[model samples]
Structure formats: structure tokens, C-alpha cells
Target chain A: MAESTEVKLLGLWPSTYALRARIALNIKQVNYAFLEENLGAKSELLLKSNPVHMKVPVLLHGDKPICESLIIVQYIDDVWTSGPSMPPSHPYDRAIARFWAAYIDEKWGPTTKAIDAVIVAGEGEEAKKAAVDKVYDILVLLEEAFKKCSKGKAFFGGDRMGYLDMAFGSCLGWLRFREKLHDIKLLDPAKTPQLVKWAERFCEHPAVVGVMPETEQLATIEYGKGLIAKVRGANPSKW
Target chain B: MAESTEVKLLGLWPSTYALRARIALNIKQVNYAFLEENLGAKSELLLKSNPVHMKVPVLLHGDKPICESLIIVQYIDDVWTSGPSMPPSHPYDRAIARFWAAYIDEKWGPTTKAIDAVIVAGEGEEAKKAAVDKVYDILVLLEEAFKKCSKGKAFFGGDRMGYLDMAFGSCLGWLRFREKLHDIKLLDPAKTPQLVKWAERFCEHPAVVGVMPETEQLATIEYGKGLIAKVRGANPSKW
Candidate 1:
């Protein structure tokens, strides 16, 4: 338990994946050092810690490193049991939460990257519209999920912000930034009113307040452009 | 607990994903009805049970359904606590297990698919060799992982077969099938001695014995060719 204070996180400020870890740590009230990683020239510690992926955010709990964002979030929930549980209490509910979290990562993450690719390439309006439609389609399903998970409560964790909230909320910044840059409304209030309200509550939560980067800040860092660049560089055919 | 007897699984005979769930259920001694899903004409139960992916295996405990193979395995482990644990006991160990499981799914699955595609297309020997080499490269890494995870024990779960074991073990049939059809050695003993030995033990385990299909059975079903056909039909460009 004493080594809990020795926790360190390797992350990039702009990464929504990294933001998930920070938000979870804040929720658990786990004080930890944050080390910024430069993707262009990854630190030796980051490489050594997560040799497989070599991707942030890697949570160095003592000398042990946990990679992948959602995995790290679950790890935090597992290790720090004193605070509000991140995943649901029941096994069935946990499975459902995990299902959606994976859905977001697998479906939403790639779709978001596609949007970024389209935007970065300054593709035709038709392509842009198609990309935007894909995101909206996903959000429509997520709105239904929010209703089911929250059970008319304020957040996905019911009374508090938990796993699903952090999983989805981390993307809000980039979503909002994309909207601002393109003058589009991905989270259409009329179409997904509950999610809009939930998004408001999620952003305002104490654990999430300072953790998420603002839309303007994302624009300043050219996050969408940089992300697509890195992704394309890694796999040219993907984007 | 009354509903524990009401367990039902929707899966295909040849799917490694589905096999993971079956092995876990067998390990836990959970008596369950197996419902075969025809991918060409998916049943209404499969569709309704998992509306999102509409893929197998779907584990239905009473009326509740859990989709995705690994998630189902973990759910079985969670709900059926009397049996041996599937995932490792410690939180860090659990994270490591989850990490490797995801690796197998993300990396190994695709590489296997590439090999299948090359074989089914009757591609040139050079293309086939390249695909086979990719799988061998992944196996080398898994061999090292086995050493780390098993810690010189009989299985990844130490004395018993656990999460990582089932995760990788499910694919043994297909790996063996590829080796047989191509007259090559994918799990080369000289290259990945630990994995080669571990695969043998995994196949012989009580939980996995009847669950995993024989390589001959896989060849009989034309699993590799059929798999590539499905993959191509779903996403023409991926394979």
C-alpha cells in the first residue's frame, strides 16, 4: 500500500486515451507523478515500460507498467478499492460496461481516426460529410446506451462518473474540437438530448474538470492533424 | 444461483473465439446448452441476444446475454466462483493476462487471417511464406510471454490452465491446420520451444480436451478457406 504513492503516468497532454487514466486517478484521489511523452522521440522509460506497444498512457504502479487506456483504468479500479468503484459492482453490469467500453474503443476510436484523416487531407465535402455521418451514427447508438446504463441517472455510473463515463467523456474534447473546426454538430442535441445533458454533467464532474483539454486547446496543438499523421505513418493504408 | 443451470451458448464449431468461452465454461464445470450459429443465416436468437456485433459466442445466463468471447470467459469466471479462477488472482497479473489476450486478438488474429487469405487465394509461394513468417514472429514473442507468465510452471495459470492459456490455446487447431496444409511448422519447436510444449499441454488439459477442434476436423470443414471468404465478404480490403 505504501508503494501506491510511487505511481507514475507516462502520457501526452492531448491524448484522450491518456486523459482517461488521469481522470480515473483523480476520481480515486491517487496522487501520482505525470511524465509527458514525446511520440516523435519516445523516452527510454516509456519504451522500456511498455515495450510491446510503446504507446502512452502507461501507468507505472511502482516498477510495474500497465499499458492500454481502458486496461489502466480497470487496473486503477482494481488496486484502489477505497474510493468509488470505476466499473460496476455486479458481474453482469461489469460485462455490459466492458462491452460498451470496448465498443467505443474498437468502433468509435477508428471512426474518429477516419474523420481525422478526412479532415487532415482536406478531402472533398462529400467525404467529409460521410465521415461526420459515421460519427453521428455511432453517437445515436451511444445515446441509447447512455439511457440504458444511466437508468435516467446523471451519468453512466448512475450516481457518479465511472468507467463508461471516463471512456466516452475523454473523447468529448476531440469531438467538440472537430465540431468547431468543421462547423458541424456531431453531438446533435435534438437527436441525442440525454447524451447532451450527460456530456454536460460529465464535463462538469469534479474528477473531469481540469483533466479534459478544451476544444480551443486541441485546435492549438493541431491534435486531429497530428493524430492522423502518426496513425498514417504507422500504417499508411489504414487512413 | 438457480439461473446458473439456465446457461446457453451461441457459437460456431470452428471459431476460436467461441472455443475460448466453451473452455472456460468446461473449466468451471458449468452445465450449459450449446446452440450452433450458422453465419450464413444467423438465428433470431443470436441477432436479438447480441444486436451490436451479431457474432458468436454469446453466453446467455438465464435471460441475460454476454457477447464477445473473452468477456464471456471472464463473466463465467466471475459468476461461477466455486470453480478454479480463469484469470490470474492478483490485479497486476490479471492486467498482464488481459494485455496478452488482447494482443492475441489484435495481432495474432489478423496475421492468421492474412495467412488464410494467402492460402485461399492460391497466392504465390513468396506471399504465402511472408504470411507464415508473420505468424512465426508473433509466436516467438508469445514464447517469451509464456516463460514470464508460467514462471516455469505447467501452464500460464501455473499448476492449472487459466485465462492466458485458454486465450492462446483456442487457436491451436487453426495453427496446426495451417502447418499441415502448407507442410510447414508454424510452432517450430526450435524457435518457440516453450510455446510448442505449452500448446501440447494446453490441448491435453481436461478443460480443453473436447472443446478444441482437431486440425483434421478444421481441414474437413475447410475452416481456413471459409474463414478467408467470410473475412473478404465482410471487408473486401482487409484480407
Candidate 2:
């Protein structure tokens, strides 16, 4: 109870990264006040807390702020040792979890951003379809990873949701949103049956329910639309 | 002793990432076989060890292979608990160490690469000078980080060469090479006096003494030149 005091989370509702911090906090059952930051006019606390990246989900535990979603998640798991461990117990398992989390950020994250860029820019169908295909290809790799990591368990954390689960699961809302907007099935059952099934259980978890922003609601938000529009107008090569 | 058995490192001598694994092993006093890989014709061992990135600096502990330099370093530290801890002990300190290490990779790493592109491409004085300036600017930020992390101590790890030191120190050879090749003082003592001193001590440390490739020798290597040449020829936007 002493550790939970003064816990605050600086986040944007539509950010998958922010969702990660929220999910981790919820999983740990730590009481925290969520401080939503406006990307357009960021609060001083947000900017000061994360001066390096100036990006959100900054978890403020007392006066100290931990930035970077995955890092924050790890910090939560480290300090809140009372809860079900978010990171795997073994060193090698932890390494593998770190590897895939990095892959998701470096590879899958960019592909999704590229898809957003293409769709928002109203690019030709070929370009949009190609972007979607790339996502599926990456998902196939993730599916294999899930198989290896889960070892026939229900979650990536085996009996319960853990680090890798939170890492990938945060993107479920975006995947759902993209699927509806583009009229495409991203988590194709055939290609990623394991992930598709895992995703369902993930979203339905008590820790996750009502946490993710609704896909329909997300699509209507100017924040989401404006963010995508900004990416669309950015240098295409960046995507 | 059991964990040390069958330990092997797949690496390229010139690579800073590979250098990290070497330094960690040296510090931990772990006996390991160094298997040099030809980047032009990568060994099947490395190809299979890191199928995802197909990159150098894979640490094989028995049959399991650990990829990613930082992850490998952490894994080495985690397994060899007998040695001086590489990562900071306190959870918050560990988070700070990780944050700065990541900054080194994502930000400082790219700036250095861009400088290599400009210098290798034989770009004009203005372009090269701008690249060098960018590097110095990053150094200034790192200098600030050094001050805060070291707390007036000798190294980023305080009393000993630890994670952040290893992360940034691995690049010393490249920094030295670039300085000599470009006839520029990249780590200006005036701007980063603490880092300049820290760099000297880091290089001279018993664990680090011969692990880093000599700048003069690195400069003469075809491997180094060819790698920079490839970068020079790549799309400028990538730099």
C-alpha cells in the first residue's frame, strides 16, 4: 500500500504504448490515477517527466518518472513483486521475451504505422493491400513465437497473462480498428490461429476488459484520425 | 561452472555489438570460445542462431543462443551472478540504466552511423561538419547523463565499469577511428571532460584492455572500410 501511493500514469487513450502501461498496472492491481495528455498541447508534467522522448505513457511513482512503455512495464513488475510476475522468471525466458517485444516495436510497429500512412493518404489499393500483407507476414512470425513461448498454454505467460502477452495485446485495439476501417481481416484465423485465439482470451481477461478503447469509438476520435493524418503527410520514406 | 560449459560467442571482431558480449564475458571471468563470422559469407551457426535479425553478437550458452547485444550482456550478467553485477541493483537505477542504454542505441548509434555515411561518401565539408556537429551535440547530452548517473563517481556504474559503460564504451573504437579519419576531435574534452576521462579509464580497465579493437588497426581493416562503403552507397534517406 505504501508503494502504491502517488502513482500516476501520463498517457494518450489511443496509444498502444499507453495501453501497455495501463494493462501492466491493472494486472498488478495497483491503484493509479490516469492523467491523459493532449498530444497537441502536452502538459508540463508529461513534458518534464519524459524530456528525452517527450512521449507518453510516463509512469510517475512518487516524484520519479519511468518512460518507455516496455521499460515502465518492467519497472512495475520489478517493484510490485507481490503480483503475478509480468516478466518470465528464468534468464533465457526473459531474454526471449525482450527479443520479441523489441521485434514488435521495431518491425510490427513500423508496419502498422506504414499501413496507417497508406490508408490515411488514400493510397492505391495495391499499396494498401501490400501493407496489410506485410502485417500478416510479421504476424506469422509472431504466431510461431507464441507457439514456442506458450508451449501449448492459454497465454504467452502460460497459466496467466505476462510480459509478452501485454506487449502484443496492447495492439489488439488498433488491429481491430484497422480491420474495420480497411475491411480486412488482420488476425486471419488460418495464418495466426494461435494469436487469434490468444487475442480473444487476452481482450477478455479481467485485467484487460474495459481498458482498451473501443474500435468504433477509436475510429471516430479526431485524435486518432489527426494522428494518422499527420503520419500520412509525413515523409513516406519514414514509414 | 556448469553454466559456463559449452559457452561460445558468435561475433565479428570489428562490431561494437560483438565487443559488448566480449567485454561482459571478460568482466565476468567466463571462459568462452570466440567464433569469428565472415559477414560476407555468414556462418550457418550464426544464421540459425539469430534467424530473425541474422546479426552478429550471438551468445550461445550450451545449446540456447541469445541474440541482441544488450540482451546478451544482461543474460551474461544474470547467469554469472558470481561476478560484479553489470546492471544496477536497485530497480529504479536499473530502469535508468536501461533507458540510457536504449538512448545510446536508438539515438547516438544512428548519429554515428550517419557520420560514417557522410565521411565515407566523401561528402562536402559542410555536410561532414554538420554530421560531426550532430555527434558533438549528442555527446553533450551524454555528458549530462554521465554527470547524473555517475554522481561524480568514476564511471556510469559508479565505482565500476557496468552496463551503461559497456553500452557506450563498446563504441570507443569507432569514435576513435572516426576522429582520426576525419581529423576531428569528436569527444571534445572541453564539452565532455568527464566522458573523456571515463573513456580513458574504461579502455584501460583490466576487463576492457584488449577487447576493443585498436583504432589504427580498425582503420586499416577491409571489413570496416567495406561496411562504411556499403552504407555510403545505400539510400541517403536511410542515414
Strongest candidate by TM-score:
2
Which lDDT tens digits does candidate 2 get at residues A1-239? 33746899999888899999999999888899999888889999998999888999999999988999999999999889885678788888889988998888888778977887887777878998999899998999999999988889998888889999999999999888777656689999988999999999999998899888888678567955665446545552332
lDDT per residue (tens digit) for residues B16-42 in model 2: 999999999998888899999998899
Best by lDDT: 2
Q: What is the lDDT of residue A221 in candidate 2?
A: 79
Chain A TM-scores of all predicted models: 0.89, 0.90
**Candidate 2 Cα deviation (angstroms), residue B196:** 0.4
Candidate 1, after superposition: displacement of residue B79 in Å?
0.4
What would the per-residue lDDT of candidate 1 be over residues B51-149, giving only the tens digit for each residue? Answer: 989999999999999999999988998899985678888888889989999999899878977876786676778998999888888998888889989
Q: Candidate 1, which segments miss by more than 4 Å at Cα?
A: A2-5, A118-126, A222-239, B2-5, B119-123, B222-239
Global local distance difference test of model 2: 0.86
